[model samples]
Each structure stands twice: as C-alpha cells, then as structure tokens.
Target: MADIPAEGLPPADYAALCDFLRARTGLSFTEAKRYFVDRRIAARMAAVGVATLRDYLNVLRFQASGEELQRLVNLMTVNETYFFREKYQLDCLVRSVLDELARNRRPGSRLRIWSAGCATGEEPYSIAIMLLEQWSRVDEYEIEILASDIDSAVLERAREGIYDERALQGLPAHLRSKYFQPVRGALAADGARWRIIEELRESVDFSLVNIADPRQVQAFRGIDVIFCRNLLIYFDDLGRREAAGMFYDALAPNGFICLGHSESMSRMSSLFVPRRFPDAILYQKPAEGGAS
Candidate 1:
C-alpha cells in the first residue's frame, strides 16, 4: 500500500508483470484483477525494500537466488480450500470411478490417485478417509495418494496435517471424530485445533508441484485418477491445454481426470471422453487400443 505510484501500476508495467506471471506459473489475470495484483506486488515490494515497480521487476527477473521470486509467488497464489470442499466428487470417486478402475486391476496391484492442486492437505486427506471408510476392497490394493501444490508455504502447512475448526466445516461430526484428534496441551482445550491422526496423515504424500510446468509434471506417471478440481479455471486457454496434455501423458490408459464442477474439459481439449455417472461426470482418457 505504501510507495505505490499515485496512479497505481502503470498499464504497461501491469501488463508486463501479468505476462511474467503467466509465463512462469500459468496464472492469467485480466484488468478485473488489477487491484488484487497491484496490492500483492506493492506488498512484496515493501517487504523487499524496493521502492519502485521497475526495481521490483528487475529483482524478479535477474535475482540470482530466486528467493524473492518464490516469496512473490507464495503471496500471489490462492490457497482457499478446506476438507471435503466438494463431497459429491468424492462420492463419485468411491462409488463409481474406483469401482470401474478396480475391475481392471488384480488384487494387490498399485492404484495411484493424485490431488493435483491440494491446498492445506484437505482434499487428499479427504480422499484417503473416503477410501478407508467407504471402500470395501481398499486393503486389497496398494493405494498411493499424492497431493501437490505450487505454493511452498501451503505445502509446508499441508505436510504438517493440522487444521482449525473452519477447515473442518464440511466434514461431518462423526467423520471428524473418527479421523482427527484434538491437538494436545492447554490451548487445545477449546478444541480450536485438531491434528489428523498419525495413521491417516502418514497415508498421504505431499509435495510441491507446479502443474503448469511440463518438466515438473513429468515426474508423475501412471496415475489412475487425478483430482484437479477448481484449479484449471485460473489458467489461460493455452495453459489449460498444455496442462491437459501433461495430465493425459501422466495417466495410464483409461485413466480419469476430475475437474471442478463448473469446469468442462470439452471446452478446452478433445483428448478426454466425458463419462457420466449418477453423482458426477468425469473425463476419461481413451483406453489402450481404443479411439482417442
């Protein structure tokens, strides 16, 4: 808020900054987001003691350590997520998607599920809980749950697996009691904080991943189901297409991808086939030896 130009970021400078972010992180911002962007940049500049927007840009571009850039990124990325944010998708996953995928796998085969934009550890942890509580054959297979995000700060918080009451709002009382226990000590008496039980926490693996980066996404392969809900909406068309291609490559034949309820793969790419179920519609990659 301090030391910003009286007129705010010059249009040219704003455009340049937006272009830089889109190139590096696949986040697209229009004029509508100018205020949000301006505020974040101004805050970061103040933190780093850069008095001018041009000087901040130079730091982002030429800084050898890349620490400031990471800090800027940490501030800009959104991390508004909570446990079971969309319960229908999880119901669809356990009730239909997993059942369909398991039909093709033998007992003891590995099944990998990814939470592509997991924030604060809730989404993937929700998935793990669903499988353990609802799926009958969960123990028959080797299950791997991987949750990732681009924001290092959120990833660190997610790895800690602690949540306050608000983050657990979507969870029912029974499920909360079953899976999470109150944090110890005097301050926890009000039940303001809860830590996921060690067993459930250890079941999920958290990592820092930028879904927009082709090189970073290459490490994820043979994933059976990908829960990328609510994330692609932030990307520009080109970024969305690139991400779709990367996901297609990472999935095994006949693997599936789940987007937010409002997101439609049909609008972005023709590579996935939309499959309808009672609870939700999911996009699936073409099976091996089948038409794409």
Candidate 2:
C-alpha cells in the first residue's frame, strides 16, 4: 500500500473523520486540529497497511474486531496531567466539601469520590495524598477514590503508579518524600523516578471509562464528590450537556462536582447549584425534595 502524503487527508475525508470521531467519543475537532488528527491517523494507516484516508475511515467504521478503533481512540485522547495540578480544588475537597458531606453521614458511612478523566493517575493519587495530609477525619470513614479515563494506555500507566520528576513538579517536597519512594536503578542525571507508596497506590481504583457514554456513566451511582477538571473542553456543547446530566444522575443527593478552573457548570447544566468557597466554586446536586 502506498503511504499517505505529508499534506494529509482531503477536506471531505477530514470532515468525515472528524464527524465519526465526535459521534463515537464526543471530542470536537475543527480545521485547526487537522494537522494533529492527520498525523495520528497516518500513523494508524501505516500500521494497518491502509494507504488512503477513505479506507482508513472504513476500517474504523466497519472493522469487525474494533481493535483498530480502540487504538485510534487511545492515540487521539490527550493525557497531560501532574500531581497537585489544581491544588485549590483539592483544598476545597478537604476544607469544605468533605465537611459538608460528613455532616449528613453516619460516623462509619462510606465516602466515594470519582476522578473522571484522571490521566496517568496523578489527579486521583493527588486526591489520596491530600486526604491523608489535610482531612482531619480521614481514618473515620471508608473512602473510595475511583479514577477513570477513556485512554487504556494511560490507565495502564496509572495502575503502575510510577512517575518522573516532571509529573511531580507541583507536589511539595515534604509530601513527595512521605508518599513516594525512589524507583530502584531508575536514576537519571536530572533526578530519580519515583513510585507512589504501595498503600496509596492500592487506595485508588483506576478504570477505563468514556464519560460520553450513558451506559458506562450510569454504572457509577451514589457518588459523594466528582472531580472532572480540564477535560470537557474537548466536547461540543451538546456533548457537554449530556455528560453533565449523566454526572448529576451519578451523584447522591447534594453531592458535589468540580470542573476545571476555566470550565463553568452553569453553561453545561442547570441541574447543579454553584457553591462558592474561598478555594474554589463547586457545583452541587439538589438534595431530595429540594429545587434543582
């Protein structure tokens, strides 16, 4: 098979591919993203020995195994994240949200927090560390930190719980020393790679999830809090609304949802009430019998 030209797919093919991707993953792409998309598709095409863009699209649409589509999805999804990337939100989790939730729960009740779009485990791992360090009653309740992402490759890395210095830049030196141990024989001139302590690693449950899919999202219910920051910008307006609605349903009454700093839940859904704290503004579902 001939190689795809450096110029990339034709306009019609590009549009078709974009539409297909949006329908399947809820990720919106404009002409500006064509270069990014084309580069990845070209790589997949070369791997599968499919030269033309149209044939590649056909493979994605009709391939019986669906393995190629999964590969493409893995490639297209971005997994840029770091420990303590958004410290304010974590502060809100410990200082405000958990206190309010605990007020309504029994002493030994379960507390569930979901980190949707958790890439490479940093966000959830950060959540665990914050809970340990800041939450006064961390040991009182049974806390579950569920981290999920659409990218299987990143999920594998998340489960491993190993990270380089770049991924830990925002993490404080004190916390770093306490939670991470240097990986043996993985030293570099810059620094040694570190692995999250085994206990912390086991605290977070990582899984593959596509928030756009109602069936997949519905599986999670009665969640106390949700952290879905810095991920919804990829979705179109309708996709955002759909995901927000699913999240609302996933939460228990009066449960909280935290979006990216730049994201506003007000634009996505009216079902949540915005609660402002000094650290951050979080969205909350109305309790049973309360107005939404």
Candidate 3:
C-alpha cells in the first residue's frame, strides 16, 4: 500500500482505493479516478466521518459488511459506454452469427447473448438493432439478450433505454432518427419525460447481476456469445482465473467470448481458442467432447 498523505489522507487516496477495488471487483482503474471515485465514495466517507482516505481504508480493513462490499465495487466500476460501441463487433454478430442462422434457417432455435457487464444497455441494444436489421426474417426464432450489471442503479437506467444526445456519437442518421427522440434537455428523458421508443425497449432485458457470483446465476448456461468487455482490469490473478473458469463452464460448445482489448485469457489459455472475424477479434470455447 502507498504512504498516507501529510494531510492525513493517503498519498493518492483514489489510487489506494483503486488497488482495493481491483482486489475486490474485476474492474479497472483509469484516468480521472479521483473525480470519479471520490465523487461516488465521499458521501459514505462523510457519513462515517472518516476525514482521511487512510481512515476509510482502516474501516474497510477492520469491519465492512456485505452491502458495504457491494457498494464499494458497484460505485467504483466505470460504466462509460455508448450505443454501437465497438461497431465492428456488432457487424461481426450480424454478418457472421445471424447470417449463418439466416442461411441455415434454424427453426425456433435461439441464439442467446449475454452482455455480461452491460452498463446502461448500450451493448445489448446495439445487439438488438443488429439482430433486427440482419435477421428480421427469423421473426419466429427467439433471439434474446440478457444484459446485466453489478450496479442496480445502472441496470435501472439501462431498462429505461435512453441516452444523452451528447453521448450518442457516430450514430447513423437512420438509427438516430428512428431509435431515439430528443429528451428536452438532458437526453435521457424526452420532452419532460416522454418514454423510450417502445420497440428498442422491447428488444432488451436488463437486470442487476454480479459476474463474481456463480451461485446467483444457475440458469446462465449455453450462452452463444458473452460480451465481458472493459470490465476485467481490476481483478488480480486469482480473480481472473476464477472468472475465466466460470465463463468456461457457462458457455456451450462453439460459444464466443469477447474480452476488452487490454484483457487476456492467456493465463487460462486452455479454456478458449482465439479466432478472428472479418471485423473483430474473439475467442471460442475450446473442444467440448472433442468438437469446438
């Protein structure tokens, strides 16, 4: 741990907190940390009268409940995502996954995707748009996306299916005009609380789910694709190993796993086989019963 600051705070209080969080959650720390972490944790600090960051650490070190533990991870994890983020992946999903389904025409056979850390619904919604655009012919087949996050607040926001006008970047004219309507000022709530376009909202299912808890997700099996992006830099070696194992168990044969650019399944190399799509990079579950 770093030294405490002369002002009784830790020398890089947020940095220390970041270290603590990585050990606790599988999320990462990045720039603007103080602005982000402090702004979220300060209220709890004030409530406890823990004037110094070091003092707060002491309490966490000494006595913290399960709820406190959850709050720490939920608040610290970043949820900065946008619609159609990593567009190449969406394109790959369209042309590769759905395209195969279209040609083969699997009857009532479903393709299940899990946006494992879907923050504010962007990933899943983008996926919905892709499915709608590319596989409209498969209207009878169920293509359900299970979008989840550790943060309940974020899950609630995701369920709303809205965004700030500013946050939407590079959105095509067709999508912007069709999917979103102007929220009077903030962009999340339109025209003094007009609702999200019901069609987009219907496409996604959002919920609070923590990836670390395997017991909480008994039914999370046979997923076709798992998007666990930009949410793994926080975990230490042990955490990553355990998470990778869980992901392996959760996936069916040939199911794809997408990690953040910075994250690697290298340590658990046996569990997945790296493969490249036309516009994206992905890993598939390795030989299940000798066939991938």
TM-score of each: 0.95, 0.95, 0.78
In the range 92-190, model 3's lDDT, one tens digit per residue, is 777775555345546677778889888888788878877776655547677778888888778888888767654467567687777777666565334
**Model 1, 7-92: lDDT tens per residue?**
57889889998899899888888888888888899889888888878788899899998788788878877888889888899999
- lDDT computed for candidate 2: 0.90
List per-candidate RMSD values in Å.
1.9, 1.8, 4.5
Q: Tens digit of lDDT per residue, candidate 2, span 129-157?
A: 99999999988899999999988899998
Candidate with the greatest lDDT versus the true structure: 2
Error of 3 at 117 (Å): 1.0
- Taken over the whole model, the C-alpha lDDT of each candidate is 0.89, 0.90, 0.71
Model 3 TM-score (2 dp): 0.78
| Cand. 3 Cα-lDDT | 0.71
**Candidate 3 C-alpha error for residue 194, in Å:** 8.5
